[model samples]
Target chain A: MQTLEMGVAEITMRLISVIETDEIFQNVMVRGEVSNFKFSGPHAYFSLKEGEYLLNCVMFNATYRHPSGIKDGTVVKASGAIKVYPKRGTYQLYTESILEGKDYGELYKRFEELKIKLKSEGIFDKPKKEIPRFPKKIAVVSSKTSAAFHDVVKTIKKRYPLAGILLFHTSVQGKEASKEIVNALDAADRSSADVILLVRGGGSIEDLWNFNEEIVVKKVYAMKTPVITGVGHEVDTTLVDYVADRRSPTPTGAAEYATPDLIELKRNIDISFSRITNEMDQKIDESFDLVERSKKRLDFLSPKRQISIEKERTNESFSKMIKIVVEMIKEKRSSLLRNFEAISHSKIVRTTELVPERLDSKMEMMKRTVSNDISKKYLSLEKMEMSLNVHDPLEPVRRGYAMVFKDERLVKSVHELKKSDEIKLKLSDGKILSEVVEIEENGK
Target chain B: MENKKVEEMCFEESYNELEETLNAMEKTDVTLEESIKLFKRGVELYKRCKFLIDSASLSVKEVLENLEKEMEIGEDDMGR
Candidate 1:
């Protein structure tokens, strides 16, 4: 010992190996009050204190998350291997697990910080993908042996048997779970699926921690395919749920969200078909009613009915005209008869026959009177003529008796005859016109 | 037989047309002759819609097998 010398690094290495191999320090469970918590470089550095003594401790990022809520002033029970940091000449506890004792202030603070950051960045505000209303092919990302898988499959089959299911089996818990889930998500994204459902059965907070990972959340946010997620119970919300296109409370709900019920669709079609058919029937009935109404209207406006009515009116007018004409004719005939009777009963007509007879009698009387008068005049003339003949001066001439007279008064006194005296000789035919040739007073 | 033309329409389009036809036929002013024509068309549309609904059936397929079959299908195939 007096002659041999060793380096400082060699001494530190020896001491660390000794403490690491110690039975008491190999797997120690330390119970103390947590303080001076500082997280950096994928690891958390903190101190555990009991009254006046303090021991430094470190927990890796892999061991816990912000939601685990381990912070200063919190009492915790930590279990891990103890080791010495030889370079710094100190020993610390390397914690693999932490159990909550008093409170989770640090975890809460970290959670609030992250939530605020993400909210400000609009990571949760992006437009969500639209879930297809009628999904023919659905891709399910879940553990094959989990009740969530069974629940989804059963529900989908019961609701919509026509929808084809594609299952992508993956780990849903433990350290490698998030990576596996992300890979499954990529696969589902590239698949010819109308929708993707990420679902899991209910579990403890730690058991369901992988869904809260930033990697998983980023992948969910970046996927082109629409994702519907149902993780744990209704209260257990994760970052992926916020980033998902659609979220459901349970695995069965996710399945429901992703597909349309075949029976329901069929029922809808049935309803629509019946509705249209009924409408068609009603329409026909309405058309018939309309046709019947129009027919009635047409009947009312029919030319035949109008013509019949007009014919009746015309016939009535014609009958009235005929009646008037007959009445007029009758009046005229009666008037003519009355005129003939009037003429027959006139005073002049009565007197016309008597007047002709009276005139004839008058004419006959006049002719008789005239004839009688003429005959009387003729008698008188005859008497006169007879008298004249008896006392005719020319009797002598007619008898051819010789009578001598002088100076024509009486030739009995021829003494009065002058020498030159006119004398006449009476003859039956005419008087002799002679001049006295001599004084013939011889007869005196 | 009179509705052979209607049978050629797509089932969605035909179904929509059927509803519209029924609505149009419901007009009160439609003549008897027009009503008769619409009724005939309505009958055709009804037949077309019924055939489409009746013919649509449920079909389920496995993922890999479905994908393989779909790969063989042309891009224009819109079965899904």
Candidate 2:
């Protein structure tokens, strides 16, 4: 209390200065499991928790080695000060030494954490999706510092150049690395990559746990992109493998999925080009065949056929017209003939009446003249009569000249004879019994 | 387009081309002409495959340019 009383401000300042200048700390390298870790602005706080015991730790923004990852549950050698937090009033370490550890306790604790978490989500039990046979784009998720990235890049470039590639730089192992991988996968999923390849070169199981994280595994499972895991060597199996669409032994193998062989692609293209062109050519040929077939069915160019068809039609029409005209002419001729018959009948009647009048007048004149002559020739009449005498119409008949009558008409000639005939004949002046049976061939 | 046989082509290029050709040929909708093209391309691919076989059969010494480079191969690759 007396020391505090003397020059209070200067003494307090000296004490604070001494406290600030003092290097009262111990640096240590511990081998134990990391536990109860926390991170606040510019500082990392964690406890190296061994079985039933704890060692406080701190890693600052600077002097914190292991350029990649550091978190709870990581076994590490840390160098720091065992100091009291003035604000919170707790004993803690301000760490400066930091290195990766290889203790069994640390490794097992992390392994158990990951396994239980992944098992709960069924990531380790789920069936993996199949990788695309032909990928248009490939996304690689791995640490840029790793040789695995180089192997993958080299193999992919050799195999397939046309296929696009997207690299996702990430922490390959250690605590919080799983989250980084998840973030990378999410980014890859957001991109238009055709396939996602989560790969790394061979390493210890602890070194490969980034892929085994439940977060990483869940991301792999949920990714719309097809993911192929190439974690560690052929013997290494991570939770990522169980949930990945496919698994490859190394980063080079992952590239096999990313891109096909350029030689193979060229040959395939050549073959496809040939096949497509051949099919086109065949189609053209088939169409030509069809066209030819149709043309054959229609024989539309024979002139002889046309001529014969025309001839038959013309003949039929000609016959019908001729028949019609002939019928018309017959009707006209009949009408004209009927008129001619009427006129001729009238003319004949008139001629017959005129002829009788003329004959009667001549006969009257002759009668008058003959009466006068008779008076004068009364005495001569006896002489005349005597001279004209004894003329008998039967004289010829009596002299045996035959006379014949047909239907009460005189027949001078016998030329109109047929097989069936009837004739009446008178011979001599007196009627004698005509019983003569002599038959003669007569000529008139 | 030149008549360089697949056997003479770079193994990567020939194999890739062959893969594409096979993919196109496998489609049922492809026409007869397409099929014929595929067959011809397949011939090119077959030649390339033959080349690969020949290459693989060669001894490591025959494959490598220098004797010293042989030592660079991984220890696990001895049998291979």
Candidate 3:
């Protein structure tokens, strides 16, 4: 009431503002082909085009991702807001859902209607629980007579030869195709397959209708192990492609992507071997050079052979020097003994001569003092000896101080020596040979 | 002026970031120092790319086992 006084223009402006910014749209579906898609971590930005009309959309990362991300040519049945961009004066969609292919909304609605109906009847929800990822046993849900089966089998063999492929033969096209395909899908689901492939090669739009059937789609959608749809050529579209967890361009493509290629593995191993070898070559070369360099630094000049030679030379010279020194020491020892003996004998002789000389000097001094008494005594004895010389011939022998003997006779002086007899003479220097023929005796 | 290629191995973002950096520097009007810095970044990417290529190899094997109870594979020995 207080603001009643305000102008109608201001009130109208307020109403416009409320209409522009405050209104929120509820769950409503829009269908279009995607363009200019941009993904930002947790968000996505894109636009959908329908002839002359274009709508901008934003998908938060969570809803945009469903088994896979959104891409161009994806026909989506999105449910979100028609919000205005104040800056661009345009309206844009804040998305909450996603569906695939053209006429996706209607198809999805039908799909969901049938899905709910079948699930309630336990036809779609209670088919089979699980398929194996690494399948030792596998059952296929395609026409046994179809090339699609052959292609799939061949591809599986090429990719993984050990896997077994069992056929759950079914019609792929025609009026009865949908029922048979659904039955086959159910059977394949119930078989030993770890993963089931609802595969059909590219065909006419009408030819692929079996996959588009709501029954087959439901069966595929509710699979436990994981259902892959390889239903057509690159351009072929089918309901199975949307409902299945994965879709490939062709049956072979599905098989190709389904498992890893052993060929690729072999190529990888070869390349890795080459890479490792190249690296090892480089490193090993470097290491070899390093070892050689270290060895050079340690004992560059003196090799083992040279060192051994030097050691041998030193040992030989040492032995030779020892031998020479030993001989010289023996000679010196003998010479020392001889010099010692000569010195001792000379000392003894000198001591004996010194004593005799001392005694002789004392005796000469005594004789000088008693010389007159000794002369008087010698004169008296000589007079008596001359008187007695006539009395005894022995006196003559005493005077001459000689005794002679010839044969058996004794002569005094030279008379007794006058005989021809063999005589032996002895001298201090040497003995001389002598023969005597006559002898004379001076005393006779 | 500087030649270096940047690449990312972990994620698309890493590669996208490298592409963005390259695009920015290749805009013809950058300073010499800025170009050099970008070149250094390119060198880093080059090293990482080479390291990955030289060190990583493709997977060699894939094994799949079927889970359905009805089918039996007695003769196909899979332990190998």
Q: What is the C-alpha RMSD of each candidate to the true structure, in Å?
A: 24.4, 28.5, 24.5
Query: Model 3, range A76-195, lDDT digits (tens) per residue?
Result: 667776665554555678887776645444544555565466557655333333334456765667888789999999999988787888788998989998889888878887877777
**TM-score of every model versus the real structure:** 0.42, 0.40, 0.32
User: Over 4 Å off in model 3, which ranges?
Assistant: A1-109, A112-139, A150-166, A173-195, A201-226, A233-239, A242-245, A259-273, A276-287, A290-444, B1-80
lDDT of 1 by residue, A1-444 (tens): 587578998888889889988876878777677899887888989989866779899888834553367778888878788899876899999988887765444544455566677778788887999999988899999999999999999999988887889998899999999999999999999999889999998765456778877788788889999999999876567777888899998999999988788788889988996797577557545544543453444344334554575678789999999999999999999999999889879998788858879998998999999999999999999999999989776686678854445446556555655666776655566556465666544545
In candidate 2, which residue ranges exceed 4 Å CA deviation?
Answer: A1-120, A124-136, A301-311, A316-444, B1-80
Model 1, C-alpha of A253: deviation from truth (Å): 1.7
The DockQ scores of all candidates, in the order shown, are 0.03, 0.01, 0.01
Tens-place lDDT per residue, model 2, A153-192, is 8888788877778899998877878888889989999998
- Candidate 1's C-alpha runs over 4 A off are A1-110, A261-277, A313-444, B1-80
User: Whose TM-score is greatest here?
Assistant: 1
List the global CA lDDT of all models.
0.76, 0.68, 0.64
